[model samples]
Target: MDLIKTEKSIEDTNKTNNQIESIFTSFMENTLFKDKFVLQASYTPETISHREEQIAQIASILAPVLRGERTSNLFVYGKTGTGKTLSVQRVRNELLKRDINSNNLIIEYINCKLKQVSDTEYRIFAELIKKLGGNVPATGLPTGQVYNKFLELIDNEKKLIVIIFDEIDHAVNKITDNFLYNLTRLNTELSKSQISIVGISNNLTFLDEIDPRVRSSLGEEEVVFPPYNALQLQDILNERASRAFMPDVLEEGVISKCSAYAAREHGDARRALDLLRIAGEVAERNGLKKVTLKDIDFANEKIEKDKILEIVTTEPRQFQLVLLSIIDIVEKNERLKDNLSSSIFTGEVYNNYQRLCEKTKNDPLTQRRVSDILSEFDMMGMINSSVISKGRQGRTRQIKLVIPKALVPKVKKILIDAIHLS
Candidate 1:
């Protein structure tokens, strides 16, 4: 063996330090390396699993159609992230696995959140007709005609049809269950196909808003999924972690922290998974192989930026602008003695909207139109309103945000950067 050289040892040490620093710098760009391809918060096969009970309930409702038998329409209810959408999709995927399409089975899943833009839920019906290979001729056709075209398409296919409307709350637009009434009419008016509808909603109020007959038809068979318990949430988080991380890389207490946090709040499995995935990303960005419990805790606090961005991306331009104004005005007025009242807030919000337009060179929507945007926020649970006694006005309402006060500044920053950060 050659004799040790002190000068060589120093060179080796410098090289090793450089490699370590390089790894950390790389982590800054790819926070959750393990979850690079995992869709943390989405409704897809890769992101959904372990929903056995809810899946079974959905199966029992849809079994009839798979067996060439007719069944009543089904309505699924639960608070946010109770796996209502995931369960329906799990069942749908299983039904698809049966792969007897030619033997007569058709399934369609639509996000009523998009299709239910107007008072009616006919957009999805038009989509369904296209899926079934029928032309409804989109020349300002009445909803009645669009529905008839849907039936005609299904009749031509001669296959049992299972239509799932995710976010069904959007369909009625506060009172438009006419779609459900006509859908359940298949057993009578549109008898050519065995049509069964599966509706997934986070709002329980939609059920109350529907016509009694439509409610009866929808609830012919119903299932409600409660939020996951701590133990259940742990299992879900652990399972996701296993797929989302390399072996032994996550610290011992990370999943437990994520589970406890989620259970304490809403027991939302989706939220828990999001926190975990975000934490891992954070850890990876820091160039650490192990994700610590502290990392997960930090993720719980920091992930709202991602959620706010998601909301901004999904909304139309004016709605997104209105939301940005709410965040900005609240943040600028954050130091006030009493959080400014809604009236003052609205005026400030309108001004902020105009400034944003000037900055981005985009046109500002009318103030009345902005009020309409507020109505949408109300439905989406992003904000709340309080009815106040305005002397003779007899209880005019004032708007307030329902989002966490802590998230206000962060949301404001994100929206501002989205518009002006070049």
Candidate 2:
């Protein structure tokens, strides 16, 4: 009986291998992409459509670099996928191309969202030093020494150094606004070279959180990029699709549906491109010649799941605790077959949240603050909240988790691990 079972298992393994080979063979034969990179978010096209005004504005602001003069520190504000970074990059490229002297201008870009790069003031200075052809120990050195090394590297040359801090708010949040104040004050210390800052953030009100001195220096010139409209997104999709896919690979209405989906997401062109690319991938995996509406649907669901997971993972400690409290209520109600599962009250969530905070040894935020987080959750589509009048008892919000029942367990696990809940 053992030998017979071994032979049966070998046969099953061979069958599975053959099935995998078939799928690979199909993928190789009917690949739908002609130039997949065109659909990627990182692709910088020869011409950026629908952002001419923003580009011109950035170019004008930074044009002083051509005369070997220090340009005003520029603050760029925009929502995600609104072409802020791209426009700034376009201007940077154009400036480099037009400037006759390269040594007089040095431009460095640091993405503050990147790990191991902008977590603290030391890392930020270390990154800048390395970018300027200087090296320092990754750790164990005093931050002042690293700052001196950076200043020395830039000051040795008679050039204007422009450091672009993308997602600058993240760095400020991690390492206070004192760093910004020091950077701005460095101009008074430097004898040869002047330094300018280009701060970029997705938050419109990021400046409001900064110290007034830092804000005045860092936001000398401000540019805001508005979200693209549905038509603008459609234009972008049509242009990218022409190059990203093979002839007749995308079925009719797929582009429109993808554009509409991204439009509802505040006109996120990156999301639209991702939707189209993922839809094509889904079609190819299914051995289809052309992407269909069903493929778009599948892609949307996949992106939604990924977006929610990312949001939950990166949220603040309080957010995770609040979300966990909701998850617990929902799970307990489901297990007990209770009818109140759909109408979890705010007071109940607050009570559970307090318990979670106590267990984690965290000082809980005020009830008003927790209520604000729930409102934010509602805005983010993680929950549905409705205000119910209790007549003489006052008013309370009726809360329900909208995070697809299937995803609840994974979100719960992330919250549990993040908060170290046993």
Candidate 3:
């Protein structure tokens, strides 16, 4: 009887294991996504929407390369997710397709925002060398040696090379503008090959801080991408949805809500797609057949929380302290009065920040430095700051937290723990 009972237990375990595997297989087979990657920002669509003028302009500038002529270096500026990178890449793809057999053109694309790739002058040149079919060590080599090797490699090829530097400002902020000068000046040393640069930046004033000579050389033809409106964003989402999701998986008004939310926040198509994707994931997790408006709300909440946590945890110590100061001010004001507003000015924030620094035994930055950090925080969407004039009292920025109110306590706790304050 004991032997029979043990064998029956083994059989039952096997049956349960098989049932779990079958359930997982069924879940995978019935997912709403036909091709989920089509919704990702990195996945460039075969056709771009609402960027015809910019595409034509970029194509015209790069068209000269097909005829073996050196085109002018181009600069493109726009807010994040305005399709600058996509448009430029699309044009490059077309150029490659046209020159499939000619072997007369070489396109090197590097995003400076990526670490260890385009973070410094050495890394940028090293990447360029490797992309040109030459190998260079990641580090420990003299900068001049890297430049010489890159120059030699390019001079050996009689092809037209176009280098696109996406997020050029990140590297420029970390290092000097000498890399730009070096790239612009490479043409003078090359005998057979010609190099043209396409620089893409989201910062409109990025050129103002760079060396004048570098700016003049790199901005021969500049293109600006305007932010997309609600209608444009909706169209983009609809096109992507048609490819990414199974039919009728998304309920009506889901796309519209995503588009409207992103359109209100500078018309970011990337954010809209992220919202839709996350909402679909939420629906799938809840075993819902269709993504609904409530799922979008949940997705927005999740995205905001994740973004806040990421920024707070990864940002510099000083930035974390500044954010903490804002949270403290808002919480204190709310506790003190039922109707008091929590909005504060730069001067007030700096004062509170200095106090926090002193209490923590850290050296405080000057008010000017704090102001600059505030501007960066504003750009990151952690805070909203508007310049307001006080007539004869001069101008100052009115600052308010953009972080979700529900997430404030969590942010406060994280900041407190990070600073090691009791």
lDDT of 3 by residue, 47-110 (tens): 9999999999999989998888999999999999899999999999999989888888999899
* Pairwise lDDT winner, candidates 1 and 3: 3
Q: Indicate whether candidate 2 or candidate 3 has the larger TM-score.
A: 2
Residue-level error in angstroms, candidate 1, position 21: 12
In order of appearance, the predictions have TM-scores of 0.71, 0.85, 0.82
Cα lDDT of all candidates, in order?
Answer: 0.73, 0.90, 0.90
Runs in model 1 deviating more than 4 A are 1-39, 42-50, 99-102, 115-120, 136-139, 306-422
TM-score of 2: 0.85
- How does residue 291 of candidate 3 score in lDDT? 94
Model 3: residues with Cα > 4 Å off, grouped in runs: 1-30, 325-402
Write the residue-wise lDDT of candidate 1 on 1-422 in tens digits: 56675998879879989988887778655444555445266535454455677778778878877678776789999888778887788788878788555568888887777633333555667777777777765548887778777667778746777888888887777435666787777757655677778888888777887789988887888888888888888887777777677778878888888888888777888788788777877787677778998898789768765665578666776677788877666655665645544243455667888887877878888988876778778787777755467686454446677777777666666666666643
Query: Residue 338's C-alpha lDDT in candidate 3?
Result: 38
lDDT of 1 at 42: 59
